[model samples]
Target: MIQIGIVGVGTVGASVARILEENQDIITARAGKEIRVRKGVVRNLSRARDVAIPLTDDVDEILDDPDIDIVVELMGGVEEPYHVVKKALEKGKAVVTANKALLAYHRYELQDVAGDLPFEFEASVAGGIPIIKALREGLSANHIESIKGIINGTANYILTKMMTEGVDFGPVLKEAQALGYAEADPTFDIGGFDAAHKLLILASIAYGIDAKPEDILIEGIEQVTQEDIAFAKEFGYTIKLLGIAKKVGEFVELRVHPALVPQREMIAKVDGVMNGISVIGDKVGETMYYGPGAGGDATASAVISDIIAIARGGKSSPMLGFKRPLESGLQLLERDAIVSRYYLRLVVEDKPGVLAKVSQVMGEQKISIETMLQRPGEGETATLLLSTHRCEERAMQQALHALFGLESVKERPVMFRIER
Candidate 1:
């Protein structure tokens, strides 16, 4: 029997305990042993939880128990979870976590600390999608070229509503929060940080890279207006917050931002609170994984899957699905180095020379406008919506800088990348 101790007993942890008990027979048969949750740790022991397992306020009881073979840290945080996981690994107990932020920063260090011990985190990325296992095992033979994903559900849900219902962001965000798709403080989910954390995990596995969240370019969906959604529809595109990682020779580019993806693409059709990831490899071409991105039962399913792997005595793979640790010498391509089509919205003075001034700045940067829209202003300013042909981000930045200096331009321009 494999005795398990779950710390946290919150939504995910409680779900893990329930699923293990409900599916005990099948899980045990598949795991080649009886997997049992001996104890669970929670802040308030008096608080009634759904799971039948004994709950305790003391974390040490589980950690100190000699019979507990595996310690599941569902606790969500950086420092305390880090210390708990570190201590659990030190005690020779196998560790499983769903904390992406903690792992994103300290994965390599934790991997070193755990050494030969099993340290599994299948649930850390996309909720129930086994993208991590697929990359680590199924596509093990191929060299990962790039990974593009709609990893966060809150942003996707908001964008979907904005596009389909023609609603603005604020109302949709409120609706999402009411539907339990978003948090009270939705910054972590809507700001692209959540997706960025997941992307860092995938990047490390695919490229052997240990890049931090601060090292990558991250843009949120706060600026995606209803007009932008309408423009995307007119151009046959869908707007989504995407976590993108691409390898160019030795250099790897990493970013999380709202993108205008082709309408026909599978990822573009993934709506509501769902997740999808498209991974390109040398041999596999392009492969996609899609499923529910978050929820108690869905995420818990993934955590239990990792537990079953441990119960079956699966060993950690040394290659870790990459050739070696990503060399620091391998340049991380800056956002400015990226080349893509762009969507630009500018509020300008409704004057004849205004267009000429904007065009001149773009001309100096050699950026060609592919499509343009002009709407008469409610007041003294008009809205100019323009799409540009493939251009370097650096050139676009330069063009925007020069355009801002123009006397005809009213406000800072809103720009979004067009993903082909």
Candidate 2:
């Protein structure tokens, strides 16, 4: 029998325990043993829980227990969970986690600490999608070319509502919160930090590259307006907040931002709260994994899969991780060095020289406009929307800065990278 200890019996932890008890017969058969939740740790003891397992307030009860064979750290936070998981590894306990923020910062260090130990985190990236295993093992033989995903359900939900209903970001965000799709603060999800954390985890498995959220370009969907959605539809594009990881020569490009993807692309079709990841492998070409990004049951399904793997003694995780991507000496691509087409929106005074000034700024930066649209705004103001030819991010940003300084320009121009 495999004894499991849950360090945080929150939403996912409770689901893990409930599922284990509810599906014991099949779980035991698949795991080759009886896998049960022995105990759970929670911050509050007065709160009632639905699981049948014994609950405790102190994490040490589970950590110090001798009979526990696996330690499931569902605790959310960076440093605290890191310390707990490190100690769990030190005590010779196998670890499975769903915390992407923790892995984004300390994955390399944890890899060093859990040497030869069975450490699994399939639930960290995209809930029950199993993209992590697909990258670390199934596609290990091939060199990973690129990974594009709509990993954060909250952000995807907001963007989908904005496009389908033509609603503003604020109203859609409020509806998402009321529906339990977003948090009260919503900064982490709407700001793209949530997706950024997940992308870093995938990048480590796919490219063997170690980078934190600070190293990559992360832009939120909060700045995206209803007009932006209209522009996307008019230009045969769909706006989606995408977590992109690509191998460009010797450098690995990792970024999370709102992208204007052509409507025809499969990734653009992934809408609502569903998460979808499209991985391009040298041998497998393009493969897509889609499922509920986050729900208690969906995420618990992934956590239990790791436990079953541990029970069956199938160690295929960090065991080959960072090493599976065989491509070596790859460095993180600088944010400014990225190259892509861009969509820009600016509100300026309806004057003759306004277009000339904008064109002259683009000309100076060596950026050529591909398509342009103009709409009258409040009073003498006009909204100028344009898409540019492929250009380096350095040049495109310079042009935006110059345009913002123009007397005719009213507000800062919004930019969204266009993906073909």
Candidate 3:
């Protein structure tokens, strides 16, 4: 029998306890051993919990108990959890965590400390999608080319509601908070940091690259507007905040931002508080993983999966899927060096030669316009939406600068990447 100690009995922790107890026989059969939740550590013992497990206020009890074979850190913060996980590993305990922010910054350090120890964190990336296992084991033979994903459920839910109901962001965000889809302070989710954290984890595993959340280009969905949504509909595209990581000739590019995906793609069809990741590899062509991105039960399912692996005495594979060190001395590709199609919405003065001036600026930057739309101005300002052929991102930045300088262009243009 494997005895487990769970620290932080919150929603996910409670779900883990419940699932283990409810499915004890099946889990035992699959794991080849009976796993027991020996103790649970929490800040407040007085807080009512649904699970019937024994609880303790002292985390040390779990850490010091020699019988506890696995320590599950469901704690959400950085410094403290880092210390706890470090201690757990020092005691030779296998650890599992769902804290993406902590892992995004400290993965390499943790992996170094956990040398040859069974440390698993399948729940850190996409709730219950098994993406980590898929990349680490199932597709181990292929060289991963690129990954693009809709990894943040709150942003996805908000965007989906906005697209379907023509609702503004503020009301929808409030509703999401009320329904627990978003937090009281949703900056982490809405500002794209949550997705960036998850993306960094995936990038590290796929490329053996240690990337911090700050090192990547992260743009939130706060700037997505009804006009942009309308334009996407007209162009037969859906706007989603995507976490994109790609390897290009010794350089890896990582970014999380709003993207215009063609309606025909399966990833674009994933809607409403769900997650989807599309991975293109050398041999597999293109493969996608999709499921509930977040929730107590879903996340708990992943945590339990990791626990089962440990209970079954599975050896730790290379956390990043590759055993050899990734080629060193290679820099992460600058965002400006990336090349892709773009969706641009410009508020311009409704007069002759405005379109010509915009086109001229794009031409100067060597950017080709693919599709164009002009809406009648209510007053002196008109809306011009243009989709461009594939071009270097630096060229688009320069074009935006030139367009902003033009007297005919009213406001700063809204730009989003177009994914086919």
Candidate 4:
């Protein structure tokens, strides 16, 4: 019998405790042992959670207990959990976690701490999808080329509603909150930080590149307007908040932002809160993994899979999937050096010279406009939606700066990159 201690008993943790009892026979059969949750640690002791496991308010109860073989840290945050996980590793307990932010920062340190012990975090990246295993084991033979994913459900839900219902971002966001899809403060998910953290976890497994959320270019879906959606529909494109990691020569480009994906692409069609990841490998081509990216059951299922993998007990691989540095020696690509086609939106005064002025500024940066769209706005203003050919991030910023300086230009320009 394997005894596990859950340190959080919140949504995902509560579900973890429930599923262990509900599916005990099959779980035991598959794991080759009787897996049980001996205790759950939550901050609040009074709040009732529907689980058979014993609950406690103190983390030390689980962490200090010698009976607990697996320590499941579902606790959120960085520093505190970092210490707890480290102590668990030091105490010679196997660990499983769903905290992306924790891994985004302290993965290497924890890997060193867990030298010979089993430490699994399949739940950290893509919720229920076994993306960690795929990148670590199944696709281990191939050289990973790129990873493009819609990993955050809140932002994806908002974007999908904006595209399908013709509603604006505000209304859709409110609706998502009411439906419990978004938090009261949705910045973490909508602002792309959540996806960025998840992206870093995947990036580590694939490229062995150590990066944090602050190191990459992350943009939110908050800037997307109905006008942008209309333009995408007109051009057979769909807007998705994408976490992108691509190999460019010796550098690995890691970024999270709203991307204008072609409508025909499989990833663009992944709508309505579903998460989809498209991974391109040199030997086996592209593979798509799609499923519910969040929710109690989905995330808990992933947690249990890690637990089961631990139960099966075998030699553990290096946490980031590499025992040594990659032979190619790929470093993180600089944010300004990123090159991609872009869609730009400008609300300008309804006049003839506005287009000419914008074109001149773009030309100065050597950015050629491939498509131009003009839509009537309130009163004497017009919205100019333009798509540009591939250009470096530096040049695009320069053009934007110059265009904003033009007296004819009103409001900051909104830009989204195209991923085809």
* Per-residue C-alpha lDDT of model 3 across residues 123-225, encoded as one tens digit per residue: 9988999999988888877878999999999999999999999999999999999999999999999999999999998888788887788778898989888
Q: What tens-digit string does per-residue lDDT give for candidate 4 at 250-279?
A: 999999999999999999999998999999
> What value of lDDT does candidate 4 attain over all alpha carbons?
0.94
CA lDDT scores, all candidates in order: 0.90, 0.92, 0.91, 0.94
Residue-wise lDDT of candidate 1 within 89-191, one digit each (tens)? Answer: 9999999898998988888889888877888888999999999999998888888888999999999999999999999999999999999899999999999
Write the candidate numbers in order of decreasing lDDT. 4, 2, 3, 1
TM-score of each: 0.97, 0.98, 0.96, 0.99
Clashing pairs in 4: none
- Candidate 4 segments exceeding 4 Å error: none
Please say which candidate is ahead in lDDT: 1 or 2: 2
RMSD of 2: 1.1
lDDT of 3 at 258: 92
Model 3 worst lDDT window (10 residues): 322-331
- Count of backbone clashes, every candidate in sequence: 0, 0, 0, 0
Task: Please tell me which predicted candidate would have the highest TM-score against the true structure.
Answer: 4
By summed lDDT, the worst window of 10 consecutive residues in model 4 runs over: 311-320
Candidate with better TM-score, 2 vs 3:
2
